[model samples]
Target: MPQSNINRRTVLAGGAAVAGVSVMTAGITSGAAAAPATGLLSGGRTPGAVIPPSDPRYEVLITGINKRFVAHPEHIKMIRSAHDAEDAVRRAFRQGKRVSVRSGGHCVADFTCNPEVEVILDFSEMNAVEYDYRRRAFVVEAGARLYNVYEALYKGWGVTLPGGICHSVGIGGHVAGGGYGLLSRAHGLVVDHLLAVEVVVVDARGRVRTVIATRHEDDPNRDLWWAHTGGGGGNFGLITRYWFRSPGATGSDPGKQLVNPPKRVIAHSFDVPWSKLTEAKFTRIMKNVGSWHEHNSGPESPYRHLSSLFNVNSRAHGRLSLYTQIDADIPDARRLLDDYLAAVMAGVGIKPVATTKPSGELAAMPGFLEPRELPWLAAARMVGAPDPVGANPEARVGLKSAYYKKNFTDHQVATFWKYLSDPTLTGVDSTLVVLSFGGRINSVAEEATSSAQRSSVIKVIFQNIWAFEKDDDRFMRWIRAFYEDTYQHTKGVPAIDDVTDGCYINYPDMDLADPQYNTSGVPWYTLCYKDNYPRLQRVKRRWDPSDFFRHSMSVRPRN
Candidate 1:
């Protein structure tokens, strides 16, 4: 992952599809969604600020990171606090206008910016990160972004949340979506440390009030907390803030409440030229990467200190890359990284040597490309893999994700090789990214949190990034065909099986709901929630009986 400059355009791009209402509480890593605010009180009971379509900020606010989706809402309600959100939600309910809640606008689906959405409750104004002495936990507002949250937590208390890797992703949908990133393997999902969430909800009687949900079993709102653990965003209500304190954290020290990532980390990257990579060699390389994770990604594995992303770029790119980071605190960290690289390059016969030999910092670190140590905070700022989605701000991208419980089968490897190596599919950027999963993430029981795929060791993303609207169809066709071919045996969807656990809600995809695409009869909800769908539906029925907050793939209340 390279540290790329995050500009305003990238900052405003939030993933659109998340839980329709909101959720609070729970440790969820991996999937990106929103974070909750304080349940105890609204900051100053701030008033909702209205921005009409006529306003200059209207177009900017209405447009999300993905240009694919846009809304012509009558107005936008910018919430500075939970009370503001309550007012906005209540107004929308009374006015009979459909509303969408937006945090970071980089969503994969059109959850926010869409034609059907009449109004958007923009939580971007509610961005705030602080340790609440009264709550005895860190409070990350729904509007908070990943980079700011990391800088605030690390700078203020030297603590961190194991959440999204993208710098500009919002906390609103990200926290509830059970998002994870580089640090997740070492700590756990960000939701794992969640203590409580504050959300604004419209009751059965059309009355909107702010509710505080906690993980306390006896708490009346415990179900709300459970739903948000990994349930995605906007399902239950509009989450205002999230309180995070480690599972067994005690005493008054907020600094001790969250996990402290390594002060520094060793970053590594390697490139395999397409020209030299034969089909046989490619299969071996991909298999080794998966098998390595299958072997080393366990709750107790010392390799948990490491995380990597293998970017299987399209043939047009000429080279494939793997980005990695390992906590430098562990003994034999360098050797461990070396062995990991050895495994990836084992049978491939691609020996990487420094062009001009070594000197200075390069002398001690022996490996391909640049492998060096840097402050952990700096590492969090780097962007990779999905970076293509945000690279141009104007880039249109399509993505599909799955959690792999086991290594890549020979057939799966062959499919990946076919799409990425095919000469005919050109003119667009596509990447089959395999992100390392497992480690402490698998330690949690599947039922412990809303994030159900706990046993998975690999998270796969099939992505295509293109610049022109005219090229959307072609790029989409390529990505879809590639994905379907990879899962041909599973009826074009990653159903619950020995190798594939299912899809991730954070990387929401509507194709799974379309019969034409998902011939597999496995309902879209089952793919994301697995057996947890039933419980989530019950929570939706209880908390959002009116179904006021809804979106594609939102939890449908069980009869």
Candidate 2:
């Protein structure tokens, strides 16, 4: 194993970060429900399709989007409702089998597909999106994909949740990890509108049952609800469904309850080729990005309605892409678009090879993938299209992520230029992606929900992907080295500080758990949960005393 890049001087900083985060939280005022209700309620059991090794679907079901890990569980159970999920768990428990749950099958890590897993409760079949009249919120099943959720909410109720741009991400892990996307700049995270969650957990007595936890102050399981707000997946329990009702919304009309995204958006996208850009220009562009977000990424910024994604591709790919979107309904929407481009491209003299926009179609940028045609860029077309990841299942990937509370330091810029332009790792398509984060997102306090990374101006992800299993190690080493050099002074990982506020849970990087890679005494949990770890631990012990729901990074309860 390779030794971590941390020096002796930086190790102590991690301990100090943990010691101080206890005061990093605040309380959110929620409406009162009838009262706290504990349940041993079991729904009618219906046996779903069971696939064993012999079944044809088993091979496909065991394979997730990432080709890195594949499950060899004894069998996979297809689930539909809360009853189905509970039944699968109870059966797995009774048989003393290692259990894992799959939603949308998009987990980049091996949480679900590992050697020890004896059974996988596949929830992709449980997808259901509908408006709950009684609760006055949209009830989305855990297995439901982002595109389906958007289609149902927008077409049926004229509303949408502020979530990731990837159309196939599952509601279960996404919402639980504080999902965000283009609209997050204006509406906040997906969890910001979370009203309640239906979770199937193992009781202290080893009995399986379902609990409905809500943000309602009087609800007994309110802590559970808080934990899921940003606690990460496979931690507390199996989240079967999430109920979304915008906070402080009191109206009866469902259409008026949730956020109303701009019906039309102005999408501008362009690319800068490495062939025409210099290292100095790239560094200047990177610094300007941090400055622009620092000045404009706020709740009251007139540019709040604008969101942008900087797909700074690894130099091996030959080009960097910029995609910006703003509510066309806003006044001076065009000017907002032009000013953003000017600010980011200020000193960089390189311009797009050609500016292209369709005659009658909506122009847009699809993040995490190449730009799509204008027709596919339309909101409806974007949602209906399959995610490029799901569209192809041959690539293996490794990820490292960071949250920036301030602009990029000159040192950080140099690190990026060095890694992205490294000629040694020839032909590797590793990318240092910068997403516009923190607008209305920062409006909430650090501890208001489980998602503690609210103050960051931008989110950065270091991603590398390859086509063959044989090349996994080379690609992983390259990306890891790239990230290590960027935070070389900070114990090999992005430690909590003024410039960097730790990592995002949604982008789980197991390297943080390895002492060899993360010499920072601050443990993976601290880097992710911060001060909120203790509260999440208490909830873990209360709801899952035996720690029945667990994985490599699952919340562990103190005995």
Candidate 3:
């Protein structure tokens, strides 16, 4: 979770695959097959604009953050100015066509890049970041990538904002969904620092108006700002830009807010041959780690400087590896590593052979190697709240998650082994990840932002990766079954209740809405939004009452 400088080449290269669409065929068809024209309203002229599928630049405009999901949209409009954006939305609403907004296009559910859409308001053209030295704030366009924002702020003002780790994730959705990163434990969610937002909201009359809401006490639209914190994308409105509030008294100048990227982030890998790990060791690791997470996540823990993420992979020489980031220098980092390793060793009752390598902050953001070569097809299940972080025997590809109030437990440790033993349940390429949560993240109150899951201790992401597209059904079913089975095991069990939040928005899977998978009738938003769903619904009603920007699991306005 260490911060890294934005590597333009990597980003451009990563984005090139999708951006390299064939211009020759971009607008060869007319009628339904042809792309729609720019939905910009008249009189809102802009310096740079690409309207409709007929434009020669259309092919370059429609590509998204995720190439896997990008397809030919009926229409794509690239807007550079806020006025251009407003005109596009107003035009789309007037035409009675469905409008889908695309920023990074990283949504796994394909909500932003759906092929059936009539129009796409692509924001990739509006990348800009301006700093107000006097106010200690910065204005960032939604199109900027997390890495771009990081580099621009650091190089221009020596400041950083807490955002996602992935260099390709667009700031648009990241901030809207409550951005979390290594810095989150120290600075809180991105919305915690959001001071104001410039949004283009569509009214019931199909008119688009620009609204500016600030975090000031007297700002009447403060609730609107709250809704954007973690409300998820396309719910309230199209956020054209965001103004970040300055961190309080980090230092007199920008250097005070900057942490010299960690000198070395030690990464350790341990390949626990499936046969060598016992149920006891697995359960112990889960429980101990879960317990440790709970214990240190409380209001009093100073462990924010130390964080760890464990990946249990079912394939690629299957291994259980731990990656930890220590905020201290080299010597203290060694001690931190020793202490953490000792805790895990004691809980699992086995000495894991670990290889520790030092890496810079940039390497940590995207990893030393390219993740593009990594498998794209993967499915995951998450268990949250009050559950003992133990593994479940019935889990076919089980992903058990927990928010520790203290440290992990012994029971959870044993469960890890039992869950991974069933080869039929998990293929050779599955992974179980335990990511660090809390720390500085918990310092902020639940009401301070839209991400109400602030009290969570840790997040367990059980994921399975596959090589062939044909195996998609099999792998997904396995993951879903594992999730259901784990839930059953905890049903009516101590400390486990119906309120268990289901999953993260970034890993969207609509199966949670199906009665077969979620018999609890706990709407999808509850898993991602917790108690903040209602407020989000109001925002949805106010902005997109017609439900133009919607997907299977999008926030639904209350009837």
Which candidate number would show the highest lDDT if scored against the true structure? 1
Shift of residue 61 alpha carbon in model 1, Å: 2.3
Clashes of each: 41, 0, 40
lDDT of model 2 at residue 501? 85
TM-score of each: 0.89, 0.88, 0.76
Per TM-score, the best of the predicted structures is 1
lDDT of 2 at 308: 78
What lDDT tens digits, residue by residue, belong to model 1 across residues 143-236?
Answer: 8878888887888888999887777678888889887888888888888899888878877888787677778776767888889999999799
lDDT of 2 at 224: 88
Candidate no. 2 TM-score: 0.88
> What RMSD does each model have against the real structure?
7.0, 10.6, 11.2
Q: What do the candidate models score in CA lDDT, each in turn?
A: 0.78, 0.76, 0.57
Worst 10 residues of 2 by lDDT: 8-17
